[model samples]
Target chain A: MSAVVSLSNVHKSFGAVQVLRGVSFEVGPGEVVAVIGASGSGKSTALRCINALETVDSGEITVCGHKVHDPALDRRALRRDVGIVFQSYNLFPHLTVAQNIMLAPTCVKDMGKAEARKLAESVLARVGLSEKADNYPEQLSGGQQQRVAIARSLAMQPKLMLFDEVTSALDPQLTGEVLRVMEDLARGGMSMILVTHEMAFARKVASKVIFMHQGKVWETGPGAMLDDPQTQELREFLHNGL
Target chain B: MSYQFDFSALLPYWPVFLQGVWLTLKLSALATVFGFVVGTLCAIARADGPPWLKTVVAIYVETIRNTPLLVQIFLVYFGFASLGLKVTANTAAVAALVVNVGAYTCEIVRAGLESIHKSQLEAAECLGLTRTQTYWHVIVRPAIERVYPALTSQYVLLMLASSITSQISAEELTAVANRIQSDTFRSFETYIVTGALYIVLSFVVRAAFTLFGLVIFPRRRKLGTAI
Candidate 1:
């Protein structure tokens, strides 16, 4: 029940524009926190900052005991504890599904091929793509490819996983398959923080829901927050399909 | 007056021509292998290394790419002799070729590297892969695979350009042909045979690269899709 990720007064800017302006939130162990907002509301930027994909210009942020805001942070160690899935699925196109899943374990962890292959098999099964062990990324559907990407991240055995609008690129049917896999992960007690536009999935699956607007957390409560919003930004964001 | 064509006059020196063909193959093969390695490394350095290293690689790439291959061979051949390096003409030729092709390869591979989206590197980093590991597994290998066709074409062109090395007394295919023509006074026939050999050599080189591409990029072959 302890916090696995915590961000207090986080600020990040890209050149002239400030993407995240004093954003703050936290997620406890086995908690699914969904960040929903408009495109430029800094939801994705906040999520990226958790993995140190974007450095914080100010404020304190910690994930899995790593001080992400610190300049000399051991990023590699921090990354080892965090797995992030992108909207693009980012699978190594040259590698088969098993190879893509096995890549980090074998190369980073120095796991033997046999052991890595077994781990890949288990994770692929977890994503319900056990039959796609030998298929290339281009050979699979978008949903199936996204599932493989999830399995690829899962193969690293990360302490926390981040999903950045993973289903944003998929059709509704394809999105359902990917969402189902994520729902299973949530049900299995995986610590997850996702930036998503899927209000239904966020309301149904996220234990905590954060509504961001203009680079700050405008409203935060349980999944029921979507039903009754205190802030105008949250109400409008929920009313309009983003 | 109708001129009679006589390739028979040059048939006696088939073994000599074959030797030249073999040497040309060796020169091209050695250059391609070494150049690919050097060029891929340079591309990586140029794309992601430290600012100073990137600047150094940039200078190397621009210098080599802007100059002519013939000039590079002449410089390498004469420069080594001037410095008392004592390298043979073949060694000079290969060295020049490796240097020349390395630059072009660097540019081609760098283009491939640039085409990779930022999300891929972020994913690699989030998976806890080290910089070296990421470059090798995620960046360089896939970049090379994507640009394999361009690299292969550049190498084949380098093979054809090996003819230019004849000026430095490399004794490769063209030099051997020149010698045969001078000795037999059958200039047209000798050159016609040499031209045929060069064509055959080019096909052989292309086949070799195709076979290599199939082996190295198994996904490209198996999936029959763009990597």
Candidate 2:
């Protein structure tokens, strides 16, 4: 099967500091790939670069068969095919949850408000927040808001979804709720690239798990590699967290 | 010389003063609408335009903000005449107020726009929204909402400052008071009544904005929360 998303030898820098250096990864259709890393490991930057949120200094990133780094590619169209969920649920504060989900569909896809509303309602139901459609982001709990954020992405009907530590900002009880949503998405065969610190969730749901350290992928294998690691850095990092 | 406070003497001129108050309201309403549009556009250009455009907007904002409203009115009225652009005093007053308030509104709006998180822009981009869609949905609406309180206060202050335009003989409230005081020779009493009229007008403006905020931000009302 062809990979749904691919990043080859990507290099990214913010001023004098290099955030991503020679990092490479790929995710096939209907697969969940978790990128495990400590803070500042460039894991989030790599995912952001794939969506063109952060411009890669060099190398290739292809999402849904479109070359992301190429100047000729229509980034807006590419982004429509690949959705990203933020760590801090960045929903529009002034818009209702339903409007938040319907925004891209109506504005970008040229769907009518009625049609977008129908889709938003369905997605909100799918995420188990249909009743909160008229509510604002601040009114919902962190986990509920994150689920709304997920539904907002799904409403666009993206081929691949990027999760950049979606549950990191939540409390433990809330984290479980968000992780459960991701697990449900995975079971429903949504292709996802998750950059997470949730070791347990990574092992349970990810088909492939990657351990990144110091702006590079240090190890890659099945979920079991996290438990039976070949690298000292991964072991030490996991142990320290424990 | 015995000067007793006689509010009854001012009662006869109440109707005339009311008309002047009405004119002041109209002028302020027009100026606020036009000024807000100019301010919002200037802020957008300053924040997102090319470096030269940014510098131009910056200069306009800073120059207007730094100078006094009195000088700005004189410049708009007499300066335009010097350049051979003849206009009425009322038009000059309206134009001056718009220009003056537009600068302050630009700065307030720019601050709100800057407060939007970079992550929000990325999220909007990832949703496949076009630049314009992202701007309208994620940037402009939220920025305007965030700075709305400041905008309303500035507009109220603009209404009070409308009195300043009477210097150009615009026939607004202050001008009417001037005429009434000269006719009645009761300067203090006339001003006292005019000041009360202004207070009532400000309250009306505030109430109108509150209703407008309710209509514009229905999500906040529905959810009973702010973000």
Each candidate's lDDT (Cα)?
Answer: 0.91, 0.91
lDDT value, candidate 1, whole model: 0.91
**Evaluated with DockQ, which candidate comes out highest?**
1
- Per-model TM-score on C-alpha atoms: 0.96, 0.96
Query: How many steric overlaps are in each model, in order?
Result: 0, 0
lDDT (10s digit) by residue, model 1, range A1-242 = 65899999999899999899998888999999999899999999998899998899999999999999999999999988999999999999888999999989998899999999999999998989899999989989999999999999899888899999999999999999999999999999999999998988998999999988989998999998899989987878777774
For all candidates, state DockQ relative to the true structure.
0.87, 0.81
Task: Check candidate 1 and list the clashing pairs.
Answer: none
Q: Tell me how much of the true interface, by contacts, candidate 2 captures.
A: 0.95
User: Candidate 2: misplaced stretches above 4 Å?
Assistant: B6-9, B223-227
Worst 10 residues of 1 chain B by lDDT: B218-227
Off by over 4 Å in 1: B225-227
List TM-scores of chain B, every candidate.
Answer: 0.96, 0.96
> Evaluated on chain B only, what is the TM-score of candidate 1?
0.96
